[model samples]
Target chain A: EDQVTQSPEALRLQEGESSSLNCSYTVSGLRGLFWYRQDPGKGPEFLFTLYSAGEEKEKERLKATLTKKESFLHITAPKPEDSATYLCAVSRGGRSNDYKLSFGAGTTVTVRA
Target chain B: GAGVSQSPRYKVAKRGQDVALRCDPISGHVSLFWYQQALGQGPEFLTYFQNEAQLDKSGLPSDRFFAERPEGSVSTLKIQRTQQEDSAVYLCASSFATGGNTIYFGEGSWLTVV
Candidate 1:
């Protein structure tokens, strides 16, 4: 079975403070790893997708890096508007399971002003 | 629409009732998905569709959960005999291509079963 676990269930960071959120996973075959931002009462907004070890992707103040068994979402100088729950999900490449995204419990981030 | 759109942003149902949620994916999107997000938890995949075909529904919790994308554009997820455990935000997402493409999500339909 594919499983994902995220660390720091809740985080509080002051404005301009940088931090990193961790996502650990165990999968049969890693097809893709995705990052998403979700606000209260809203669906997840796609952020980044990392496909291979050592692969990295960046968008504005957010950067995502992937390893063999884990992925990290690094936030740089986050602002209050960046406060939201961050989620990590994975897809299986092998044929055993269908195309379903297995998601982590998520890390709730709050950026203080 | 520019992004995936869902109807009934909020819903309240009593036990044993049935509810239907609608989803309109992005124009020309080839794939659609349904997910359930419980409070303080990440969204969990419920089902998938490739065009009009229901490909994978392994994640559905029970037989009462039914989903369909008849025309390859709009989809509906119907839950029968709702239970308190069924309360969650049902999210709908769509992608232009298959698994590798980015999946855009709607605001989601918050369902509360009493």
Candidate 2:
């Protein structure tokens, strides 16, 4: 069974404080891993997609790195506006469609000024 | 439209009532999808559509949950005999015709079964 587990269900960080969220996975084979940020009462916004191990992607103050067994999302000097629930998802490499993402429970990060 | 749009941003239904949630995919997006997200949980896949063709409905929890995309651009998810367990946010998403394209999602339709 393919599963995704995110640690530290909720995190509180001070403004300008840096932190890292973890996303661990177990799957038969991996096609892609995706990261999304979702705000309250809204759908998730795409952040990054890593297709292979040892790959990384960055956007603004956020950087995502992937490995064979886990992934990490590093936030650098986050602001209040950056607070949101971060989701991790994976697509199976076999016959599973690329869009059929299996998501984790998500990690909620709150940044206080 | 500029992005995927959903109707009835919030809906409240009584037990045993049927509710229909609508989704309008982005213009020219060939693939559309429906997901159910419970509070505090990530969205779960409910169904997938490709140009009016219902290719996948395996993730649907029960037979009472039905989805259709008759025109390929607009999709609807109808829940029959609503139950409290059926209450969740219904999210609609769309993607391009091919490859690993980014699946864009709508604001979602919040359903509360009382």
Best by TM-score: 2
Over A1-32, each residue of candidate 2 has an lDDT whose tens digit, in order, gives: 78999988999999999999999999777888
**Model 2 off-target regions past 4 Å?**
none
Q: What is the per-residue lDDT of model 2 for residues B49-87, given as tens digits with 9 covering 90 to 100?
A: 999999899999999999999988889999999999999
Model 1, position A83, has a per-residue lDDT of 97
Chain A only TM-scores, each candidate in turn: 0.96, 0.96
lDDT of 1 at B26: 94
**lDDT per prediction?**
0.92, 0.92
Give TM per candidate. Answer: 0.97, 0.97
Question: What's the distance in Å from true for residue B68, model 1?
Answer: 1.3
